[model samples]
Target: MTSEKRESALGALQSNLKKGHVYRREDLLISSNAVDRHLKQLLKSGVLEKLSQGLYYAPKTSIFGRLPPKEDDLVRAFLKDEEFLILSPNTYNSLGLGTTQLHNKTSVYNHKRHGVFKMGNRSFEFRIKPRFPKKLDKEFLLVDLLNNLNSLPENKDVILANIKKMLTNFDLIKLEKYVLLYGVVRTKKTVLSLLHDLR
Candidate 1:
C-alpha cells in the first residue's frame, strides 16, 4: 500500500475505535493492511494502549481521569473468549462472616488459561475450572467461601461456628446445590458434616 493509501486505511481503523474496548492485533488487521506500522504510530500517539503482547485498548477518559479497562473487556480480549467469570476475592466480604481482607488481585475462572497475567497496571489470576456459576448469589458465595476456606487467613474454626449459627440465613437448598456443584472434596465434607449436625 502506498503511504497515502496506508494513512487512509489507518484513519478508517481509528474511526471505529470504541473507548474502553480492547482489541487484538488480528481484529485491527481487518481494517489496515499496514497493521504493525500503524500500531506503533497509534500507541505512540496515545490513541491506543498496549495491554499485552497482541492486546490493545482505546483509553477512556472521565472527569476522574483516564479510566482503566473494565474487567470483562480486559479478560474477554485476553482469553479471546467470553465464557469466563471475573471476581474479586474481597467480594466475599459481603457475607458478613467477620472477614474483611482486601486484595488488589482479580481472579478469573474459565476453561482456558491458568496462571497470573499482568495487563497494564492490573493483575489477573486465571484458574482453569470445568465449571463455575454463571453469576453470583448469596448461596453460591457461601459455598464458594467454604470452597476456598483453606486459603483464608482467619481462624477456620471461628468461621465454621459463625456459619452454623448463620445457617438459617441462607437457603439450605441453594447452599446444598452450590456445594454439590462447585465445592472441592474438603468443602463437601465440611458442609455435609455441618448439615448433618443440624439434623
Candidate 2:
C-alpha cells in the first residue's frame, strides 16, 4: 500500500473507531490497508492502546488526563468472554465485618482464565471457579469473606466472631446456600462451627 493509501486507510479505520471502545485485530483487518502497519502507527501515535494479546482499545480522555478503560470492558476483552464477576475487597468493608483494610486489586472470577494479568495500569487477579454469582449480595459477601479469611489482613478470629454476630442481619437460607455452594472445606467447617456455637 502506498503512503497516501495507507493514510487514507488509517483515517478510514480511525473514523470507524469510537473512543473508549475496544477492538480485536481481526475486527480491524477489513478496514486496514495493512493491519500490522496501521496498528503499529496507531500505537506509536497513541491512537490505540494494546490491552492484551489481540485486544486494542481506543481510550477515552477527560480533563484530568487519559481515562482507564472501564473494568468490565477491560475484563470482557481480556477474557474474550462476558461470563465473569468482579469483586473488590474495598466493597467488603460495607459488610461491617471489621474488614477495614484498603485493597487496590480486584478479583475476577471466571471459567476462562486463572492468574493475574495487567492491562494498562490496573492488575486483575483472575480466579477460575466452577460457580459464582452474576451479581454480589451480602449473603454471598459473608460467605466469600469466610472463604477468603486466611488471606485477609484483618484479624481472622475477630472477623469470624463478627461474622457470627452478623448472621441475623442476612437471609439465613441464602447465606447457608452460598456457604454450601461457594465455600471451601475450611470455610464450611468454620461457618458450621459458628452456627453450632449459636445453637
Model number with the top TM-score: 1
State the local distance difference test value for candidate 1.
Answer: 0.88
- Give the residue spans of candidate 1 off by over 4 A: none
Residue 187, candidate 1: Cα error in Å is: 0.7
Looking at model 2, the pairs that clash are none
- What TM-score does candidate 1 get on C-alpha atoms? 0.95
- Candidates in order have lDDT scores of 0.88, 0.87
Clashes of 2: 0
Winning candidate number (lDDT): 1
Q: Per-residue lDDT for 78 in model 2?
A: 78
Report the lDDT of model 2 for residue 45: 95
**Weakest 10 consecutive residues of candidate 1 by summed lDDT:** 190-199
Alpha-carbon runs more than 4 Å astray in model 2: 193-199
